[model samples]
Target: MSRVVWGACLLVASTAFVACADSGQTAAVARLASGEVAVSGTPEGIPAHAPARFEFGTEASATRVAMWDIDVRPDGEGLPPGSGSVAQGREVYNVYCVACHGPTGMEGPNDRLVDSEQWDDVPSTRTVGNYWPHATTLYDYIRKAMPQLTPGILSDDQVYAVIAYILWMNEIVPEDTVLDAETLPAVVMPARDKFVVDDRVGGTGPVR
Candidate 1:
């Protein structure tokens, strides 16, 4: 019995059938051995088989894994041990955050994060003060990604401080309030009730 195997060759797409001629046609063969089957010319090498194993990259190190796994949950599960006041947060915000977000959270070159209560009466842009439902999410987001130019550079206390400043500007917290793991999650945003629960039934169960 004879076995047929398609060679890894460039396939030609044509509608009409053309017979092999001496002009310029080359036939691709799966197996090529000395003094064996010859098409336009004699075979060059032996049969090529698929590779059994493939080697690409190395395993990730523990340090690298820890760096990427830095997400904080809504329940303040991953919060670090640190605290900051609104005053301290304002200083950090003026120094690092003001360049993009402007002097106050309302005066923004980017999205406004404060003075957004007017949105309740009129159709306005969604700022953190009016749209966000949780305070802990703010701390998590800023700590993971902020300072746009240089993210993940701020210390835990600095992250808490900057978050406090934003919250104070939004009127969600007192100016003298300090933000930490315990206090951050306890903050209830004004729009919390406005957001409806996700009750969509997925293929498996309820998405909620």
Candidate 2:
């Protein structure tokens, strides 16, 4: 008696089983011995038992892709069109940010956003103002993830406003300054010079 074994094969679009008969019972014996059996009805290289096409999900729409494509770079490349003042930022911060960051941004239940000491002072607590290397990153971070409870809930205007308020509290910007794509990136951070470039290439040792 000849034994028949069904071997599983995976096509680019579908999965199917290839029939293999041992004991020289059929033409598939030679191909099956080489682990490459040809199915009767399938196309040249495809298995006959496989479906013509199979896909897991629908294609993503342009609008859906755009929604997740929001990312701001250090040079302010991707900043959206919006403007926000310190006063407006204060309002937005009080409503949405004060609970986690506290009224002045110093007394925070979360990470502190303001620090009175200069970067050279080597402050024990690493606040945003004393440790952050770029001002543009503040806008990126707040816009993408903020408010503790709900992330990405703030509009562009609101995000700019909140950043302005935080910058003012840190003494990095004037209390009356308004933040926008044009002005926000140009605001130099206090700790900008503190960070060193990582020029080291691949190695097994420490980064230094």
Candidate 1 residue runs with Cα over 4 Å from true position: 1-66, 116-123, 197-208
lDDT of 2 by residue, 53-79 (tens): 667689888788767868776667668
Locate the minimum summed-lDDT window of 10 residues in model 1: 8-17
- Alpha carbon lDDT of each predicted model: 0.70, 0.76
Best by lDDT: 2
The local lDDT score (0 to 100) that residue 89 gets in candidate 2 is 95
lDDT score of residue 203 within candidate 2: 73
Off by over 4 Å in 2: 1-65, 199-207
